[model samples]
Target: MWNTLVSIFPYAIAYTIPMLMTSLGGLYSERSGVTNLGLEGLMLVGYFASAITIKMTEATLGINALPVGLLVGVAAGAIFSLLHAFASINLRADQVISGTAINMLAAALTVYLARTISGSGNVRIMMGIIRKNVPFLSKIPIIGPLFFSQSYWTTWVCLIIWALSWILLYKTSFGLRLRACGEHPSAVASAGINVHKMRYFGVTMSGALAGLGGSVILITYSGEFNGTVAGLGFLSIAALIFGQWKPLGILGATFFFGIATTIANVSQVIPSLQVIPPVFFKIFPYVATLLALVLFSKNSAAPKAIGEPF
Candidate 1:
């Protein structure tokens, strides 16, 4: 069991990072009062954007194309999210309906564009971020092997972003205002703050981060865009709920789901796991999500004014 865990730990972390980014994005959106059900669509947009960008530039830019592709993905996600932001914040449309429309539009639009550009609904990349062990740190006892060895550079980058986000959202006055927009928009407006602008920032940040999550999938384990993130985007939303909308809580929740996912993916090859039905592992995360929601929905620490237009 120890050996198996050691071997699979890196892969679990790899899977967790993208979901973590996406879930964290949801945290921002919901914290600021907008319910962004369009995260799945935003992720798909990033995945498609990054795939095409890398495919077109890899020959000329080599590994340099990876960052370029990621940036393009982020830009695409943010731009695409504006549709949701405008409808929810400006037009005062039903947030859920607007988010659903974003998801539907992204799904059809990305595949159509992919086919138009590549003659198929899929685009493959030739390169990805190479994994490396942190020197010295990797030499530490068990902790080093699991956390520092065979890690992608992107993992550290995302973790740093997560840390900064925690500080920005919890430690700063701006974060308080942002959170206030979700909890009491009228009170914030009475205090002379622009609730609409804060919500816009929150929603835009969610899109940018979700895009980064999608790009991470393509450049890391996935290496291709097939018009879906295999529901990881939705899974991230579940994690957000399960985590109680806090940064540390999200980290733990996503990592748990990631480990569950890795187990399901690798179960066929592992002797001990082979005895358990693959279906069990496959449905574990979703089932757990449902249970978490059933148990916590009433007492959920979600933003009070979430999904309501200011």
Candidate 2:
């Protein structure tokens, strides 16, 4: 049982990183009074951007592709998110509607670009790779393999981002102002803070993180880009809800979902668990998401001024 568990731990970590990034992104947007329903679309854009950049760079420069891919992915996510910010924050359109539009646009644009770039709707990556493994610490005992061993930059970066988010949200005045803008924009505005600017920053940050999530999917886990990134954006939203919109909470939620996801994919390989059908396990995350939504929807307290234009 220990060996089996250890063998699958790395995969779980890999899956958790992207989910963590997305959930954190959701936290930023929703916490700041914007319902970023377009997370899925944003991620799709990031995925395509990262993949295409890597492929193009590899073909043209023959240099290390991972760095190029990472830069492109972050830039794409930030750029696309700016659109959401402009529509919802600057234009003062309905946040939900703006998010929806962004999502749709991202999906459409990603598919079209992917087709144009690869001559198909899918792109594969080769050569440059983001490997998994910790420096020095990976040499530790059993826990090391489960946590530190064979881990990608995505995993470490997610952890760092999670920590930064927690500090920013709970410990800093900037975070307080951001939260105030979400909960009581009028009050924040009265205090001489720019509510619209805060909202724009929050929404843009969310997009960048979501884009990072997409890049992680392409560079670390799948090493390819396809439509497979579609449902993950929704899953990340669920994770945000499950985490109750807290950064640390999101990490826990992501890990739980990651474990469920890994179990579903690897159940067939475990001889001891051959009796369980993979189909049932595969549906676990979605099922859990539904349950979480149903249970938390009534009690979840979003920012009071959320979704309201300042």
Candidate 3:
């Protein structure tokens, strides 16, 4: 039991980070009154942009390209999200429809662009990937194996982002305004706040974070662009709801989902679990997600103006 627990912990962290970041993005957007459901599409653009960048700059940037690729993804996600913001916030289009268009366009566009640029429809890079341990931290007996040994700096970055998000959303004036914009945009605008601009900021940051989320998955685990986020973006939305739209709550929800997700993939690595049908493990996590939503979503509270345009 102890060894199984230790072995599975790191993989859980790998899966959790992306969901954590993307859920945080959704929290920001929804809190600011724009229902930005294009998280899935935004993440795809991020993955494709980062992957293609890494492929092109392998020699020049080397393994350091991971961080650069993430930045590129952030930009790509933000730029693509900007279109949704314009349609929803400026044009006053139905926010869900705008988001769906983004999802549709981003998915098709990335595949076309990736195929055009790579010719073989795959973009991969050898960026001198290496994993290192934290010096003194890894010396700890039980804690080290569960944390420092198998993880990358990306895990720590996600933890820091989660912490910062909590502080930014709950303890800052900007957060107050963002929350206000979602619950009562009229009150915010009447108070002399620029509601439209706030919504734009929220939506843009959401895109950036979701892009970074997708990039983390690529750099930390896959090391290639396979042209899809594999529904992680939608799962992040579920995580946002499961967490009840709070940072700490989202953390807990993503952790559970991440662990559930790993069970199917990691069964081959554990001898005791080898007898279980692969199909059962494959379906388990998704079923769990559905059960979680069905059981918990009705009790969930959302901002009053979440999908409302200013």
Candidate 4:
């Protein structure tokens, strides 16, 4: 049992990393009075961009495509998120509506562009194009097997972002200002802070982080672009809510979701658990989400003035 669990640990980490990135992104946007309903759309853009980048680069450059693919994914997510920021922060549109619009736009755009560029809506890249194990640490017994077995760069990047987010949200003065702008923009404005500007900064940062999550999905898990990225974005939003808008809390919630998701994915393969149908296993994550919402809805609190326009 221990070995079996250890063997599956890397997959759990991989699953958690994407959720962590997206949940952190949600924490940023919601912490600043913006409801990022478009996380799904932004992730979709990153997903497609990463897969397409990898495929194209591999075909043309004949080299490792992971780095370029990740960059493209991040850029695509960031660009798509900018539209949401413009609508919600600059134009003062309804935040929920703006996010929904962005989601629709991303869905349409990704499908159209994928079909146009690749002659199909799906893009795949051959594996082993860019594989790297940790130096000496990867040789460790259980810990190494669990963490460094088959992970990608995304896992480390997510950890760094998580630490940085913790610092930015808790220890930094800028984080204070950002939170102030979200909880009480009028108060922040009275203090001579540009409320709108702060909100915009928060939203953009959210988008970028969300994009990074999408990149992780493309590069680490799927290695291709498809419709799979959309659901995870929504899941991130749920994770953000579940975590009550704290970076560390959100990271924990993401890990919980990731573990459940990983278990669901591998349940069919476990000989001892073969009696569990794959369909039921696949629904486990969603079941957990529903339970989380029910359990946390009353206790979870939003920013003081969240959803109000500046």
C-alpha TM-score for every candidate: 0.98, 0.93, 0.93, 0.91
Question: Which of the predicted structures, 1 or 4, would earn the higher TM-score when compared with the native?
Answer: 1
Candidate 3 lDDT tens digits, 36-85 = 88999999888888888887777897777878888998899998899999
Per-residue accuracy of model 4 over 1-310 as CA lDDT, tens digit each: 7877876777788888888887888788888888799998888888888887788778666546777877787788877788888888778789899899988888888889888988888877775324457878889987777677666766877798799889988899899999988788888899898988888777877777777788787777676777557488888887787777888778887887777777777887789767877777556656766777788777657787777788
For candidate 1, give the lDDT.
0.93
The clash count of every prediction, one per candidate, is 0, 2, 0, 0
Candidate 1 TM-score, true structure as reference: 0.98
Count residue pairs with overlapping backbones in model 3. 0
Arranged by lDDT, best first: 1, 3, 2, 4
Per-residue CA lDDT of model 1 for 1-310, tens digit only, reads 8889889999999999999999999999999999999999999999999999999999999999999999999999999999999999999999999989999999999999999999989999988988999999999999998999999998998999999999999999999999999999999999999999999999999999999999999999999899888899999998998888999999999999999889999999999999988788768878887898889877878889999888
Instruction: State residue 82's C-alpha deviation in candidate 1, in Å.
Output: 0.3
Model 4's alpha-carbon lDDT is: 0.79
What value of lDDT does candidate 3 attain over all alpha carbons?
0.85
Model 4 TM-score, all chains together: 0.91
Scored against the true structure, residue 217 in model 3 reaches a CA lDDT of: 81
Per-residue lDDT tens digits of candidate 2, residues 130-203?
46577878788977778987777667767988898999988999999998887888888999999888888888
- Considering only N, C-alpha and C atoms within 3 Å, which residue pairs clash in candidate 4? none
Please tell me which predicted candidate would have the highest lDDT against the true structure: 1
Per-candidate Cα RMSD to the true structure, in Å, reads 1.0, 1.9, 1.9, 2.2
Which portions of model 2 miss their true places by more than 4 Å?
59-63, 128-132, 293-298
